[model samples]
Target chain A: MEKYKRNERIGAIIKVLGDNPSKVITYNYFSELFSAAKSSISEDILVVKKTIETLKMGRIETIAGAAGGVRYIPIMDDMERKDFINSLCNKLRDKNRIISGGYIYYTDIIYSPELVDKIGKIIAGKYIFKEIDYVVTMETKGIPIALMTARYLNRPLIIVRRDSKVTDGAIVSINYMSGTSSKISTMSLSKRSISNGSKVIIVDDFMKGGGTALGIIDLLKEFDTKVEGITVLIASKTPEDKLVKDYDPLMVLQHLDAQKEIVDIVPYEHKDYV
Target chain B: MEKYKRNERIGAIIKVLGDNPSKVITYNYFSELFSAAKSSISEDILVVKKTIETLKMGRIETIAGAAGGVRYIPIMDDMERKDFINSLCNKLRDKNRIISGGYIYYTDIIYSPELVDKIGKIIAGKYIFKEIDYVVTMETKGIPIALMTARYLNRPLIIVRRDSKVTDGAIVSINYMSGTSSKISTMSLSKRSISNGSKVIIVDDFMKGGGTALGIIDLLKEFDTKVEGITVLIASKTPEDKLVKDYDPLMVLQHLDAQKEIVDIVPYEHKDYV
Candidate 1:
């Protein structure tokens, strides 16, 4: 006997899938929960999928096999994505965001849960099929978005530390030159943070010099981890050429005039980073 | 005409609510989307609330009046909360997690998106009705969970920096001694991060001497913000008398015999910390 009506089961199913995006939900799991046959659960998923698609929320994909299950892939459709990016660009373009040294302050935006959750989902949507093992980022501004991306991708997050700490156990420290400057700085990663030969995508809040991204890429090499892709919430327009050639940025910061109190930032065209 | 059927609307409604916990969504929003009357949306919410309650997933609370709407509150229940805390304690008990300085190496656990998400929800559940304006934490390990807490609470997060940076645009710096040691370290925050006389909760990954939490409390005082409560993922049992008397912890670290390879940790009883 079924414990819940179709609508109740559908509601609960959506809650579970929404709670855990990118993580597969087995039919048997739902079947046991509802005390219904797998066929009934599959039929209910069809309704849920149609409703979500009609609403343009995202996509619900089902895998067919013994290891297969349904997963929620957060693909903000084109119009919605464009609107979101445009709104974000507007938020970043605030005149008050320009600091004295010509640095654009968007620490609050990237630190926002709703905002960063969307940013993470968009980043995760790019590499849904890339078979990523971990979402990698350098501390500390990038941790929130990177963690959100890891959540959407259902992957672990490996945070590279600026300095080696005793709590990290065995650490690997490496020095890399700042892309836009002559100064060199060090970045360290815990040896056990990632499995060797794992695939990782680097994420950050901003890419001015690209020095930090380059440093992270070099540090990841120690673990024999493959750099699948690199992404940033925003990248500077100056230094048109970055130390790293291929990185996807959600927005491009074109101009920041501390004197005029002007800040010009725009959303970048969405492209798969991995 | 209604755009979606009853079950479909219920499914999508749950998805929307689950995606945004503690955020108010008006019936008008759903009515416009589904082209259904407010009465219909109200009835759908009834089903959602019943299903969620029956399954012990959480609660769907409805507010009655202008500027009011329905919101989801994540309540893990006593049994589930116990199970979760117990599982975490078991994970922390691994002897291999001990470092040279007796520092437990649970950074991986705290950095895990899934684990930290649950931890954040559990923490946020405690302060759901506390009228918190913001969630505050000192970077960098506490950020993931803090951001998660802020997400669940629908509030902004204020991250204290170890050192003041030009990007911060008028930073406030303070030196606080380490809880376990007499070593003093400087922590900074942007002057504009919080408004004067705001209410906040301090969150961190670990607390030994409560010096860091105290430092954050003191730092927040600079902004004239109220520290309603403080929470940490783990606290040492040795410091039965911590500098801060009223803070809460998810787990208590009883003892760690590095030489004997034994780790004693346990779940804390649930209590209203605020």
Candidate 2:
């Protein structure tokens, strides 16, 4: 095997760590990959750590144990995340985004890969040590952001469906009253999708009534799953009291007047959890 | 101002490149980021390039001119991709994955963030130079893989809804015959989802008769868009002739006997285009 230089090993190590965020990578694996001694690999890791910290890219947590190595913990600087959320809010405030149903047409922003990826990373950064078992979401518009969140968390994604399909095998379904529409809606999850006692974070695109997220929480209960946190891209400002008491939204949709073609969106002033 | 050493610069460069695959990063950007000269950044990129190529990680392309910079292009070695597909097929061959309706339970595998991310990268690798404007998928199961593919391609994602929702604003609905059920199904896309005369690739989790893919193609035509190609995770073997021709699947489901609890799956033998 060709031995890699110090720079080569550092570059490869960063790439691998970034690819598998929140997942520990064994030093033995890196040592083998570079055809170098563990001591040299250790030295390379120090350089990689400095690079990440100096750039404020993210934090690298080193684990000390038989199964320990280092894991990349994605973090958005407080000021940087605020700026990002503010910019995204600005984009959502476009007057043309107003639709007839008092809804903002944000399908373009949430479906955007680059922007969604950043949002996911930001959300994932909030719960780096939450020990989340899975990232869950209701079907349709939420999958993109949910999947991105799961990617950053290095966890599996579980999608709750609107209706159970034969392909889902046996499933758990529940009904909840929508806060916005006041209509009863059913959400389903495959019985085998999540394990009992597993902790998960629920992510979604839009949260009007918080009914969908509550429905998902109820559905997860059937499997004895625990929701670690609830996150959404946008939340309606009206009806301050949501079905779920504790949930975070990236932006607060203060008002959307389709008649006047106006959409007011502001970044959520989240608790200083970070 | 602090300056990044050679290894630190290489590590940071790879991280930036990995984060923005298929997207260019100007030398000036790196120069500013590292507080280093453009010449030093160029040398660091050369080392980064060597590390990636030597490890068969992927290919990096350098563009010249005033807009000159480096771009990371993800590609799976042909053999590595085949091995990954075969291993995924083995996992899918589980006897308990059989449901009563002749449909194999693959929700777990496809919903798996790590596995789905790899599948997306492999699919995106095949069309790196296709200049795809967007990565499209129908609602529900395909969103994870499709989102991952779009992330790697650095493009937007467009999801066709099974039914029009109030939040969709104005939509273009198309009715197409289901390939397996032979029943009429409706799919809708927001009119402003895709630009006119742009090219997109349709990605889905499963393709039984390719009816859904065909429906998406028809829906995109309403926007005067071109369907560059179609890719799926699995395709049924019985209906070898699908509604859409020239599509590719990562795996082929040879047979599924629910009674015997048997599912025979094989990795697709793709053309040696790589």
Candidate 3:
């Protein structure tokens, strides 16, 4: 096989490393693939690493030892992150987004690949250092962001269903009261979705009373799994008494009056990151 | 700003172009961002373009005009795509995946980011040249894959819900028969999800008799939209007659016997691609 040029090798490395975020790739693998020497591969990696860092796209962590290699961790610098969240807040603050029944028409943002990818990276960056076996979310709107987060973290995404379906086989269903409506609702998960003692991070598009998150927590308990963290794109400001206490919300819906077509949103102030 | 090295500029260019697939980006933006001349940026892009093409990762198209720039289109060679599908089929062939009601427990694959991303790329590649306004799918199992497809295609994802929620505002609901059970079911979509005369592509995780896809087609009619294409990860072979006539299915599940745990699966032979 012909040896790949420096530019070719660098592009291939970025594609591989970027595709498998947080997963280490040994230099030997690249050297063999490119028919290049280890030192040359190392030089190529340095260029990729520096460029990534300079652009604030992500970080490349190098492990030194017999079983060592480099891994990509997607991240956004504080300025970019703050800018992204502020822009998201501004978009959410649009008066036209106020639909009937006090809800915002933000499905476009939720499902947009570019926006969801950024949100996933931001949320996944927070828990990069933490040990999370899986990223979990309920059915419908949350799946896109959760899937992207799982992709970045190199973990499986487990979605909790609103109702148990025949396709799920044996499922563990739980009844919980909706924090927003105070109405009882049932959530179910297939028995094979998560293993016992697994650690999971829950993500969702919007949070009102944290009832759905609470329901997920209860469902996870049924599997003997633990909820490591809960994150959402937006959480309402009206519900001060949240069922799930520990959580991370990117933006807070300060106020929304459908009748007046007024909406106020602010980025959540993270004590540590801020 | 210090002028970025060729290698550094190449890496950053790949990230930016790769991140926004199919979206044209002007050289002026890159030239200004890197404090370099337009000619220098063009040289940098050439190298990145050749490298990507050599690796068969994707193609970089440079349109020459006032509205023209560079756009990245992700693709996988026939061998890689076949290998991916074969591996997916092998995983699905596992006897343990057989659930009680002749259903396959493959939610893991549906929610898997890596697999789903690849599937999305393959499906999106098929329709890259086609003008599609939105990538549509039903709620639950299909959202993750559909979301990725929408992301790669750079289009909005429209999800049809099993039932209309109050948050959806005004909705258009339609009843359809389940191919497997022959039971009537209702599917709804927000009125604002798709506009009149929009062209949509329907995607799903599994198809029994194409009933769900047909339902989506019927639902799209309410908005005067058209179903340009329908793609699914897997489709059952038992019911040879399908509700939807034209569709692309990755794999044909020939047989699945829960009692014997016997299964027969094969990749769908595309008339053109094959």
Candidate 4:
């Protein structure tokens, strides 16, 4: 076996830790992979930790004990976070995004891997200390953002379907009034999708009256799971009566006159949370 | 601004490249971020690239020209890929995973972020050299895997809906026979979801006769898009008469007897392509 250099080991450690965010990686694992001693690997980890901290890229947390290891926690510094939100709001302000029926075509941003990964890091950073077992979301548009969040948080993603199918086996279904259209609709989840008594973080792309988020909350009741938090990319201003009140919205849709193609968007200010 | 050290700059560069896999980052961007000269940043990148390659973690390709930069390409060596598949097959071998109607309850694996991330890396690694515009998948179970693949490939995800909704606006809908049960089903995609003349890689969680994959192919034709490739997590062996001819499946399901709770699973051997 070839000897490993310090720079090579540090680079590999950062890559492994970054890939598995918020998940502990034991020293033994690294030592074995690098064909090095535990003490040497520890020095390499310390170098990674100090470098990451110095650059404000992220943090490498050390967990002590028999089942302990180092974990990576992704972070977007205050300046970068503000810049990202500002740029996102600027992009959303484009008149070309306005479609019929007061809708904004922001699907491009939602699907963009670069943008969604940053969004996920910022959102997941808010709940880094929470005991979240899973990240849940409604189907279709929210899948990308929610999946990214689940990746950052190191948890599984549970998607609630708009309509149930037999391929899902037995499912628990519920009817809830749509907050945007004021029409009743059904949302379903596979009985085996989520375990009982799990703690979940509900995420969505857009929240208009919070109908879908509310439906997710109601659906989780069937499985005896608890929602630890709710987050959304954008929340409309028209629907003041949001079905779900507690949520960390990144941006707010203040006004959009589809007929005139006028729009007003602003970043959400969460006084209570990061 | 504080003076930046070589180790800190290299670590930051690695993190930035790793976070934006398959996407290029110019030296100018790094220089500006670190307040360092372009030549110094170039040297730093060379060191980082060499270190990563030495460790077999990934690649940092430096594109030369007026319109170029450094890009990261993630790789899972043969040993790691084989171990992932073997362990996955072992997990799938559990008799309790055999649900009613001969369906294997593999949702747990599908929802697992860590497992799905590795699966995405392996799948995306194959197409690292292809000109793929989008990563497409059907609604529901395949979303997580597909989303992770899209993230790794640095491409946007286009989800074909099983049922069209009002929120999607105008849509292109198609009906295809379900491969497993021989039942006709409707699959729709928003007209705005995909652009014309784009190349797409279709992915799915499971395939019983390649019906859903075929449906996606047929549906993408409506938008004048080309099918660059087709990949799936599992393809059942019973349905020998699959709708699609060319595909890159990760695993093959040889047998699934519900009453006997027997399953024969094996990793796919693709001699023609990566």
Q: Please give, for residues A47-80, the per-residue lDDT of candidate 2 as tens digits.
A: 8888898888998888888998988888877888
Question: Which stretches of candidate 1 lie above 4 Å from their native place?
Answer: none
Steric clash count of candidate 2: 0
Q: What lDDT does each candidate get?
A: 0.88, 0.88, 0.88, 0.86
* Tens digits of lDDT, candidate 1, A35-80: 9999999999999899888998888999899998898887777787
Error of 1 at B175 (Å): 1.0
All models, RMSD in angstroms: 1.5, 1.4, 1.6, 2.0
Error of 4 at B38 (Å): 3.2
**Candidate 3 vs candidate 4: which has greater DockQ?**
3
Model 3 misplaced stretches (Cα beyond 4 Å): none
Number of clashes recorded per candidate: 0, 0, 0, 0
Quality of model 4 by C-alpha lDDT: 0.86
TM-score pick, better of 3 and 4: 3
B112-138 per-residue lDDT for model 1 (tens digits): 888888999889988988899999999
lDDT of candidate 2 over B12-124, digit per residue (tens): 99999999988999999999988899889888888999999889889889998998999998988777888899899989999988877888888888888889889989999
Residue A19, model 2: Cα distance from true site in angstroms: 0.6
Candidate 2: C-alpha lDDT: 0.88
Give the distance in Å from residue B122's predicted Cα in candidate 3 to where it truly belongs.
0.9
Per-residue lDDT tens digits of candidate 4, residues A109-169?
9878789888988889888888999999998788888888888899988888888866677
TM accuracy, model 2: 0.98
Instruction: Estimate the lDDT of model 1.
Output: 0.88
Q: Write model 3 residue lDDT over B122-179, tens digit each, in one string.
A: 8888888889999999988999889889988999899999998887888999999887
